[model samples]
Target: MPAMDTVVPPEGTILTERRGTLLLIGINRPAKRNGFTPRMYKELAEAYTLLDDDPDLRAGVLHAHGPHFTAGLDLPAMAPLMQRGEKAIPPGSVEPTDLGTPGYRRRGKPLVCAVQGITFTLGIELMLAADCVVAADDCRFSQLEVKRGIMATGGATLRMAERAGLGSALLYLLTGDEFGSAEALRLNFVQKVVPAGEQLAEAIRIAERIAAQAPLAVVATRLNALKAVEEGPLRAMGEFLAVQQRLSSSEDAAEGVRSFVEKRAARFTGR
Candidate 1:
């Protein structure tokens, strides 16, 4: 495993390894209900970059080691930073980029999260970037920045609208109201809802399935799907074909073909 950044306070978070295929990121601030300090986001950004570059890791699972996933940003940590200027964040801070992009972008593999209790503002934004999410049935979801005297800047207006459609997305964005996990599932914001304690295990089962698939193919498919929604379909299709041409020439492609002909599971080497 790579050396994770030291920015993360040892008390607030923990990263546990699972078979070298699944990564478990746990928010440990139960006293704060896992509310994030600026340092935590900086640590998260660095951790994400580390995971992005790891060849052996096939999937990541974000879960909290507490009753709540996150209570949103730490107000005390954010207030001083905001007082400086919108863009005047301290070095290594992961406050939302004023430039309208998410703080860190993961290119390959999938991110699956298990959310429970409350997830507000930036929590919801992080979930938007995830490929799949499993929430406890009692999870409370919200976009509370508007009521907090600021607009949601963590890609909520753009990505949330795309995930939940204009009307449903607007309902939460406009009113800053709380919705249950059922509503999140109905709006297609989350993939599944399990009983409270089952979320992490369920997410791991899903991530393991994702890990078993052909890695390069998974990357190509996700890239195309994200592009189709954000960029034009033509551009997405063009990129898809370009990726296909390269992947088709890979060793994993050969293994898949051979495995199919042999009538067995493909032992994809992710070549």
Candidate 2:
């Protein structure tokens, strides 16, 4: 494992580190159940931007340090912003880019998230941005913005339909209802549900497994999958191999061959 770099944010809200090839981002406001202040969002955005440029990072896992994964947005802090008429991005103001991070392009790397306890509104939105999600067995999920007389402004409004299908997404969004982990899993909103305390560890394990794979091939696979939806299935096959061919010369690819011939587990350097 490489030496991991730690990043600590003010207000003790964000904890970041590179664990092997897995970039772990922890929302650390346990007192308020990991609720987001505007500052937290800004910090998270900055972290994502930094991760986008890191060549050493092969995969990422979003996590929280607390009993509850998140209680969603801090209404007390955010009420004033809403009152001031500040809002999420205006419709069609710009094309959807990089999971709707204001002006940034998409980071092609795969992201996984571990969720537990009170997931609501923005908490659910966070999952929409992740490529895969794992929830604690007792976790709760909801999109309660409708109860507050507002609509989801995050990617959930768009991604949810594709992620969970129109019926399931609409039921939760329109009624502002909450569901438990079993329901979430059955509905395809979460990939796996582990015991309550094991979410982060399981997520990290998955990320590390992904990190051990061919980095370029992983990105290419994700791209082709997404492209098959937005572009076309016919184009995806060709695009997939074209990318895999380019990755054949990468250092990690060479290490994979050497390790196989040496009859030992491959120690990927993530080159």
Candidate 3:
């Protein structure tokens, strides 16, 4: 984490703060079990946009204010909007789901998520979209949209199989079976499992580690890996030499070499 910078507090269903180069976005609708009402969905997408567009923000952490990360989308509130064929977000804004389509823009920056208690449906998709996830031991996860007579409209169907394999993804996703944090780890849904109350801190620590690295390299690394996953190995492999040459020519690369010879810490300026 960069040094704490006092940021003007955000007032909405989503709470955002700028701390150094990291953006902390928290779900604030705890009273309603942090459900994604249409308002909350739009606010979160705006926060994601801020993280992507602001050069100062290198990464982001998504957590919740209450005991649980979320109980999933407030279907009654969101169904009407979906029925009307309207996006909850305004025009020219990034959609939170990051589902590749004509209007939805993919996010370039990295995001880490922390979860505990009940995390269902959209909550699972949010984690699937994030770069990493820290799950508390108390978490109880489920994909309950099927039970509600709907299906996951987020990235779950597309990405879950990538992480957990097709059989495992269908095992729970099709059955709406609830699983614990340990199971989440075994399924590769979450990277780390911490005790209750430590999830957000663990996610912040991981984000801080990401922020301390060379910014351009970090972004390129993420993009390249995403390309391998989304596009294919051949597509990502074709650009390897080009990307390496570009990074080697950067000022940060020179500083990295100099710091190694001097036996000191490298100070990266995101150059």
Clashing residue pairs in candidate 1 are: none
Instruction: Find the candidate with the highest lDDT and give its number.
Output: 3
lDDT of each: 0.76, 0.76, 0.87
Candidate number that wins on TM-score, 1 or 3: 3
Segments in model 2 whose C-alpha atoms lie over 4 Å from true places: 1-12, 79-98, 257-263, 267-271
- lDDT (Cα, tens digit) per residue for candidate 1, span 29-148: 777777877666665655555556788888888777667888888877777776775432334332232122344344466878889999988788787777899999979998988788
Q: State the lDDT of candidate 2 residue by residue for 1-271, as single tens digits.
A: 1122254343446668877677788787777888888777666765665566688888888888767878888888777877897743333232112464454456678888999899988888887678789999989888989898888876777777877789888988899988999998887778999999888888888888888887776887788898886567887776756677777778878988998999988766656
Q: Point to the candidate with the largest TM-score.
A: 3
Q: Model 3, which residues run further than 4 Å from truth?
A: 1-12
What lDDT tens digits, residue by residue, belong to model 3 across residues 147-261? 9888888888888899999999999888999999999999999999999999998999999999888888998999899999999999999999999999999998999999999
| Pairs that collide, model 3 | 1-208
Residue 52 in candidate 2 has what lDDT? 60
